[model samples]
Target: MGPAQKPNVCRQLSRRALGFFSRDAGVVQRTNLGILRALVCQESTKFKNVWTTHSKSPIAYERGRIYFDNYRCCVSSVASEPRKLYEMPKCSKSEKIEDALLWECPVGEILPNPSDYKSSLIALTAHNWLFRISATTGKVLEKIYLASYCKFRYLSWDTPQEVIAVKSAQNKGSVLARQAGIQQPVLLYLAVFHVLPFSLIGILEINKKIFGNVTDATLSHGILIVMYSSGLVRLYSFQAITEQFMQQKLDLGCACRWGGTAGTVGEAPFGIPCNIKITDTPPLLFEVSSLENAFQIGGHPWHYIITPNKKKQKGVFHICALKDNSLNENLPTVTASGRVVKRTFNLLDDDPEQETFKIVDYEDELGLLSVVAVTQIDAEGKAHLDFHCNEYGTLLKSIPLVESWDVTYSHEVYFDRDLVLHIEQKPSRVFSCYVYQMVCDPGEEETTNRSCEKETNLNIILNSDNHSSDC
Candidate 1:
């Protein structure tokens, strides 16, 4: 018989969970495979219009195209057969759909120097920040100017002809006023921005039943002005919007507004260098003045914290356990494990945080591991971990990963089943990026603990792949 193929339980799990998060908050995966497949795989890897917003009736422009409200551009002209939402589409003139550069498109974050010429600029919806996309490509053309205060939350837009889009993070949505150039969109609101980029950004609203709670709250639309980037309020948020638009002609660095009106810049108002300071968080801004020496900082923790640099490039990311956090420190080393233990992980060539390397050839072969590391978006957001593992993994000791974590929580629970625990994952990216297991129950501890059994052990690893050989 031919060599056995590895089963793909992991991918199966990711897909199902993803569908549940994006569409029905109530829709949950029956197993771990469902959540793994859905979140990790590129939305393109699956069907298109899997969710209502992607579909026509559920979410489409007057032009009969998938209106990317964030950038205010038609994603593509040659629409897909609504049925084939998961199938890939050929490039055409009408819409420009790109999955490869979705997460970390380099140009979007590339900061243009003083010499480089920038054509037009606009603020995003929630005043989260602003950006400059390629006038022609809508690819973040350049990032020359930015405000350096208050984090912009989200943004929504309302065009002249009844079109709407919200701009938040890559995972969050942005409203793109594709109609008028940087002149300022009419009837645009600050709140109500509920769409992500035209990429694989998926959201799982656990607060309410996915798309539930439709109250007068939830910030769908608003108008406000900023005295500065701080919480200091001005008159009408709309006044701030109007003033910022007019200033675009005079002030080279004030096209974006903060506080509430996300005019265009995604982070423009938050990082602007003009000495016009806004709301400053906590103590004075902290900066790592030195980087030659460092000290260790973790002891058998469950998850490690990775501080993202303001500027990012392309590359592969191995699991890391930051050993130190002193004023002077060397780069932290990652203890690569989990799905990354066997395969290669690549970062997006453009922007590292927004887009990641989507695996096309390895999905069916690697299973759940693929779902975890098809390369992932490290965008600003929140998520949590949930798991129940078997015994073989539970027995291992002094695991490299367990000691590598920068932070871990200790929560022991009693169970009726005689099951030893081993598996774990970070519930949220904003909380902890990954989860590690360590220190199995001792014989004495087992006798006292309800979850573990001292009499017998269990191993949960699966057998050979069935699809490849059964075929």
Candidate 2:
């Protein structure tokens, strides 16, 4: 086999159809389906309407709260007057507004699955009935007391999926159940966004550059409450869809007891991905975690790689731990790479607080990147991610995180290598760039005693910084 072409041994690099997805040079696994769903659900619904009964037609017509099912927003109404669903007299086809009611949501309960993000919230309506319904799964999950004259709403303001939802209480009556596990069969309300706190919107708009990609609130299958203040935003994520929806519903009289006056009605309803086309087979996924602000919070972002392969490993997610007090470095040693990137923070002799620390991103070549984080789930099974930039911090690199593109309806696979290997910058170039991901498994070290030498064949792979505790 001379220097001739051979049979392709790797996945073919995509040869796009010229004007494919996003206009940008990068990619966009476009999921028009999701966008379509959003168009129909999130934006079509009137901000204050939540009824679709024939009887409510007169009122709906008055409120500008109606649309053709075709508009098919990903969110649906919560609860309304009984005659409301039937109040509106059926109109002729010519009178339709929204486009596709893909499939009418069955009469049932919506169970939410609160991911790490607080995209959804549920509330009760007037008359003490389970009026407001919002969740990821619009299908029936549990049963509610028909006698409960309370209504609920899901808020969506700070999310990407549908909205940052919050549950509210309309009329008065029995407060929400706080039992360990109660079931309520319900309907799924996809997106909702009540009035959002000015603080949040202010923070986002002010720091758009860094948080351009920060987690936006979205409609989720779970219950979440976002606490954004004091530079910390805490999310109370519920495991089950109905876990906490009822826990935070408002009191009677519509006087919001949650905290603020921010509240809104349904946006859209979620749909089952067209089961017809999607195969039961799953796509390869990668899971990785990186800090929002590694070297700089609103600074240069980071990048990871997912090579074409099986495991779908993830590249390094570099993170830096910065504390209020600077670190005092030990006498720094110049590595074989000719550059001196220190590890141990040395302190100035006289003043302990005023110590020497690395001014990350000070060099022209070294820009800011992502960061590593450690989440220690508390005894209550609450995983508290260290969002602080103080004290000792761990810079971790994880692998195998997966993200889907709702913009593109196509499903694909992603695989990356576990970050741990590095390429030693040789005398080859003046400023040789060494690219690699590092794996830091501190818990496994004492028992495994694994040496980098045993893991690699490249002499450059086993450099000094590639030690068990360092890189």
Highest lDDT: give the candidate number: 1
Which tens-of-lDDT digit does each residue in 1-471 have in candidate 1? 222343365665566656634454334423444444333332222111111111111112221223232234333223221111111222233333211011222234443353223322233423333343433344454332223322233423432112222322222123453343332211212222211221111111111121122111112123322122111222223223333332232233335553455444323333432221112111221122111111112346422323232124222222234344332334333322221123446534664333222211222311321111121235332212212122111111111111122223222111101111112223341211111212222332312322222111110100012211100
- Cα lDDT, all candidates: 0.25, 0.23
Per-residue error for 152 in candidate 1, Å, reads 13
Residue 409 miss distance in model 1 (angstroms) = 44
lDDT of 2 at 325: 17
Model 2 spans with C-alpha error above 4 angstroms: 1-150, 155-166, 170-223, 228-231, 240-471
Worst 10 residues of 2 by lDDT: 197-206
Q: lDDT per residue, candidate 2, 49-101, as tens digits? A: 11111111111111111221212112212212111121122334433222111
